[model samples]
Target: MRSLLMVSAGVAMLGLTAPAAAQNMPAPMHMMPHDGTLLTVVAEGRTTRTPDLATIRAGVTTQAATAAEALAQNSTRMERVLAALRRAGVAERDIQTASIQLNPQYRYQENEPPVITGYQAVNMVSVRFRDVAKSGSILDVLVREGANNINGPSLSLDDPAAALDEARRDAVARAAARAQLYASAAGLSVDRIVSISETMEGAGPQPPMMVSARAQSESADTAIVPGEQDVTVTLTFRFLLK
Candidate 1:
């Protein structure tokens, strides 16, 4: 009989301690709002702006009987291209060496062993243009300065944080408006927000465009058309209906 009483007392203590521990635990991100019905809504917000910056890839390819000769020839031409960029007001910090390679050119036959014809060397630099309007003209100069290969004019906003914040605000407003509409339809009032999650959808890159050596954007001039770019934000919101 004494043991039974002691066991009952221990169980009572355990029950008290369990409640206290649960109260001390941190709240979950998606905690229910006092047993109210939850209403979830998803919406998207998009903002459009013209790109203000651009990136271009320019390089030279050289061939020679020896790897050393090919590399030397490539290095000289690449220097000319770099100088042209400098003359065009391109900052040194804006130019980055993307790649340099020397490979043996091989001629393959069906039954015979492959023969090494010559060595080819390639050097490339990635250049950023702060002013997209002048980028095309500068590219023409690069081609004239012995850049044999060119690709891209990847356009983007210089700073996207402000635009993204605007998008977020739009997303929140859209989600709340949608949830409120649902609450009204169900004859319930929106009590509080349970949770919110967001996804950023940035603009996609432009297709890769290539220009041969000395080729210009147009006759006697070059033009860069920066079409409108869209930045999107998607949000899911959970609200409690009282």
Candidate 2:
């Protein structure tokens, strides 16, 4: 079916850097849901913000001839890591045990059955840092206290309600702009909005731009650079043109 003046657009994150072309055609009467020309405008709202929180996976891994021995060594190191976290003002609620694993290392032979050589133990926790600026120093302390395996610094906002609301407003504005453009092209004006709805594309914490700190000495330090993440909300607006 032909449209009177169809406007459909896609926007880039952080800003509407690119916009899809708007198409104008002869008005059709059979394919609309209203008396006048029906215009459906789809637009995305986006905002870039520096993350306010960091989630780090810090742990200790140890290998020994037996599972019991490996676990013992890992426990000893993990205690010190916990102590350092508490000393650095990390709240107990922000730290949670992720996993505790013990596996047997096997030596494979060409024709003989596999024989167990040693056992490896790993203890890990998911640590959330509310203060992104100070997380680097805290990570350094964790390293000094015997955290051998560390990863992530998953960046995110503490409370995204405000940012998402901002995006919602942006979407509405974009939809309005596109609708006006459509009305003008079709030799009509925007009468009113027939319907409006939103689609949140799950604008959660961006992927981890991790500064992995692994097997570092006391003299070494870690740094966390919180870049920017895009929070986006997509909206579809149905406007009537008269």
Put down candidate 2 lDDT per residue, 8-106, tens digits, no spaces. Answer: 654211111112111232224243443455677888998878899899899999999999999999999999999999999999999999999999999
| lDDT tens per residue, model 1, 3-26 | 000011112111223233235423
In candidate 2, residue 11 scores what lDDT?
26
The lDDT of model 1 is 0.75
Candidate 2, lDDT over the whole model: 0.78
Query: What TM-score do all the candidates reach, one by one?
Result: 0.83, 0.84
Point to the candidate with the largest TM-score. Answer: 2
Instruction: Tell me the alpha-carbon RMSD of every candidate.
Output: 11.1, 6.6
Best by lDDT: 2
- For candidate 2, report its TM-score: 0.84
